[model samples]
Target: MYNKRFIIPGLVIFVLFVTFPLWFNAFSTASPVPKPELPPGGEKECVAPASEMRDRHMVLLNEWRDGVLRDGERDVITVGGKQYRKGLQMACMQCHTSKEKFCDTCHDYTSVNPFCWDCHLTPEEAALKKETH
Candidate 1:
């Protein structure tokens, strides 16, 4: 059949396209992402468990954002039966003082550029901007 001529070449091209990323990554020299260091002051834990916070911090933050901005609710969040105020710059940054070392490590690893920085800045970022100008 005339169609027989195209089938072999088409299958070869299809296989190549499907497996390109695996081949390219095997040849590349990319290093693994480093883990974020804990904050100073020996803070023992987050409002939630380390596993929950690592996986779902963004979901928590988004709920906080909606509560604060849209609903005008400035209430404390209860996690692990402990109450913590619900504001990023006010509460979260109290422990996570270094945004670059703490936040950027995970965010960069996942290729996520959170817009939290669009409105908020770490104490260090504010200081740097003041010094630059």
Candidate 2:
């Protein structure tokens, strides 16, 4: 009778301590995919090939670097005064707010990391806080 009682409790304890953690870990395991590394010798691909879709991404990066637009303001960006809508509604912070989710999605697929983050803030205005403090 004593042997039977001890065997049942030992089996229950072993399942709880060992099997439960293994089951939980299988669902929580993350992918082993590595993040893209920075380029060398001054080679960078900020915009995709010169396509219509890529034009907006280029304009947005250039304008942000030049300090043309203020944060949270809707300034009409007209490339050559033609009123370019491609990049009009987009902001630097839109994708960069969640760097891992938004930026990593495309960057990981393409295997390139843009250097824009080196100098500018995601929201553009937030960089000012770092400077003042």
Question: Against the true structure, whose TM-score is highest?
Answer: 1
- What Cα-based lDDT does every candidate model obtain? 0.83, 0.51
Residue 74 miss distance in model 1 (angstroms): 2.1
**Model 2: worst 10 consecutive residues (lDDT sum):** 86-95
Using alpha carbons, what is the TM-score of model 1?
0.74
* Error at 56, model 2, angstroms: 4.6
Residues 46-101, candidate 1: write the lDDT tens digits. Answer: 77788999899999999989999999999976644556789887777777788888
- Model 2, 1-109: lDDT tens digits are 5798889999899888888967776889655565433322233332343354344665556665455445544455443333432231243233234455555666666
Could you tell me which 10 consecutive residues in candidate 1 have the lowest summed lDDT?
76-85
Off by over 4 Å in 2: 1-56, 63-90, 94-96, 123-133
Show model 1 residue runs off by greater than 4 Å. Answer: 1-6, 76-85, 130-133
All candidates: CA RMSD in angstroms?
3.5, 14.2
